[model samples]
Target: MTLALSVDGLSVWYGEERAVHSVALEVPVGKVLALIGETGSGKSSVALAAARLLPPRARMEGRVLVAGEEMSALSGAQLRRLRGEKVGFVTQDALAGLNPVMRVGRQIAEVFQFHRNLNRRESAARAVESIEQVRIPEPAAVARLYPHQLSGGMRQRIMIAIALALRPPVVIADEPTTALDVSTQADILRLVRELCAELGTGILWITHDMGVVAEVADLVAVMYAGRIVEHGHAASVFDRQQHPYTRALLRTLHDMRAGQPGDPLFQIEGQPPSLNTVITGCPFHPRCPMATSLCATEEPVSQRFGGLEGTESGLVACHHLGDQAGAMT
Candidate 1:
């Protein structure tokens, strides 16, 4: 299968402070790779940089390959052509991402206009088709309404419709289901999974919710302190987590294991390190339960246990993997 996106040695800096380390990832065609981490762990920074969407003051290094283009080397016009045409982006907050003043249908049509050079009638028809594809009720009516006039879920579906209108090879969904009710969230996720599969679109799903990853992700890459601490198949990563951080995040989930009603939730001790602080060894050591002198002064080597690349079961980064049988799920 062809990979929709690939990042090699990707790193980003805000002035002298580094926000992302040498992070490498791949999202194969029709698969979702979840970039999981708590806030400030630099997962979003990595995803945004993959699309050349980082902030103005941020400096980036390494290669981001997508849609037959090297993102890091693209010229201004070429970069614009790549986004929304070959690489679509779905932001977290639909209400914020869409213009309140613009009619929903017109906004979706703009994507067709930019990439397809379609006339207004053609764009409008295609936009309604997209709205229908996303399963919105009465596409024609929704098309005429402004963003605020729709429910949160409707607005989100509209956003997804815009992304799908171009049939991009890859879609970057940054918490697209956030701020929605539980039922709405499920609908949005199902829509994304179904639409991407139908279109053969690779997805980079960035979220802090392990439950979301469990339900939708084919592969998982756990990020902490600007670096990937563990990456593997979603099943193995959760069933036999090799890194302390991955285990900690899993234990924090509400449904992972049975606990007393009065018991406090499990949480990783200590705070995530600030970007201003530099560490020579594993950045997570301070919060990791298995930290040692080696963890404090040296980087952990990545170990691949599987033969097939991108299979999701054969990888980990750690100095203390312990006995696999006894490791926390």
Candidate 2:
């Protein structure tokens, strides 16, 4: 079967300011691939590209395939169908995603009406069912309320309800649980996991939280300076990360110390270069402690270490993966 989502040699730019640099990834059916990066790392840019959701001024290169259809090459009408029925997208800010003037129910009902060509009455019933599926109480009443009338978590559930209602083959969830409380966040995460396990929907999960990634991701990709620096199985990347950027990120994960209270967090030196900044050699060399003279002037190609069924190696773009591997053993 064709992959649910395939992004190859994809580059994105906003008026010559690069947002994504030749990033490539795939999310197969029933799997979750999480993109982890700090702010402005271009994780969201890649996610949006999966549905051809980039801003009007943003020029995109390469091709995006959604369940075997080339998204970038599609006509406007075709793109709309792909976005509406083939891939469901959930944004981080539910309030922003929802129109304040539109009642939540009518908004979700639009999916059934537009995609499935259901009549108003039928669509309305399905809309309520969608709400109930996400475990929102008082579905009918909740649907009648405007987006602002609902709590943050409730609004997010509505977003998920809308996305899952159509049973899209691929789901791009861009930090869907970032704004919710811990308990509510866990509920949403569990819902997404269950969807993947039971429904066979491939998911591209974009978030900055490693905890969230650990909870939901089967595969993990680390992005830095608009490019994927490393990608591999979650277990492999977490237990034995290869890229210096990946290692630095893992080292900074908060831990429960045996006796020490409030350990000072490890911080990576320097900040990520701006999108317009001219980066020579490795973009990460400026802040990476393991950088050498060679790293300062040469870009490293991705090298594989290990993958699923042992066919794909954990891929890393770093000058010292070999030395890092030796040191680990």
Candidate 3:
């Protein structure tokens, strides 16, 4: 089966600073791939690069194929057409994603106008349909209201509705349900999963929430310092994480799950290295507990794990996995 989205050796740089380095993954149609990492781990950068939405100052390299088309090769007009028509995006900040001055209905209908040859009435009808599909109550009234009138959850739902209006084959959602109550977050994620399954849309879900990943992800890619450190079937990655960073994240989640009470939450120590600094070895070495002297001098190439049957493309970038086999366990 052809992948809905395939990224190979993708890298992005902001002038002299590299934000992401050689990240790659594939999202098959009807599958949900979660890109999980803490803030500033280049999760959002990866999402933007996939959609060809990176800033003017940023330079990108490598292949980003969406629906068999090379996103990086598309021209201005072609890329514009592909953005909303072939690939949709729901940004992390719904308030910023939506136009404050425009009516929510018109904002959504604009997608139809841009991607489809629908008149005002037809576009309005379709926009209302999209809104209802995302489970927004009183779709008509919600359509008539401005972005300011809606609650945070409602705004997020509207963002999703707008994104799905054109039925794009790939959806890149950057923390689409953040800042909502637990109940609302569940509802939003369920709606996204259901809609993607029904439409066979590939979803690249960028988030830091492991709970959400456990609920919706078919595959999981753990990113750090702008590169994918570990990727595999979501179940396997959760059950048997390999990379030290991935293990730390899982331990943090376990701490949260146990309802550990304290203002001082557990976190990986040390800050991420500056993008301008040339990282000779693993970018995660400074904070990695299992890092060896070799890890500080040589970069570890991603390698497929052994002892796993029916697994493909599962990779971990680490030098100590051989010696620290029992660390994650």
For model 2, how does the per-residue alpha-carbon lDDT over 16-88 read when each residue is reduced to its tens digit?
A: 8998999989888888898888778888889877778888998889888878777887768878876858888
| lDDT tens per residue, model 3, 1-329 | 66889999999999888899999998989889999886777889999999899889988999998888878788798888878877889998988899999999999988888788899999999999989999877899889999999998898889888888888889999875336665677677778999999999999988766787888899999988899999888887887787889888888876654653342333667777777778989889989887779989999999888654444337899998766556544
- Residue by residue across 1-329, what tens digits does model 1's lDDT show? 58899898999999999989888888888888888887788877887898788889999999998855677888588888878877788787777789999999999988888889999999999999999999998999889999989988898899889877788889987874336655577668778988899899998988655666788888889988889888878887887777888888887887533544434333567898899987878888888888899989998867776567645455577878654535533
Backbone clash total, candidate 1: 3
Q: CA lDDT of each candidate?
A: 0.82, 0.82, 0.84
TM-score for each predicted model, relative to the true structure:
0.92, 0.92, 0.93
Please give the distance, in angstroms, between residue 256's alpha carbon in candidate 2 and its true position after superposition: 12
- For this target, which candidate reaches the highest lDDT against the unseen true structure? 3
Q: Judge candidate 2 at residue 326 and give its lDDT.
A: 95
- Backbone steric clashes in candidate 3, count: 0
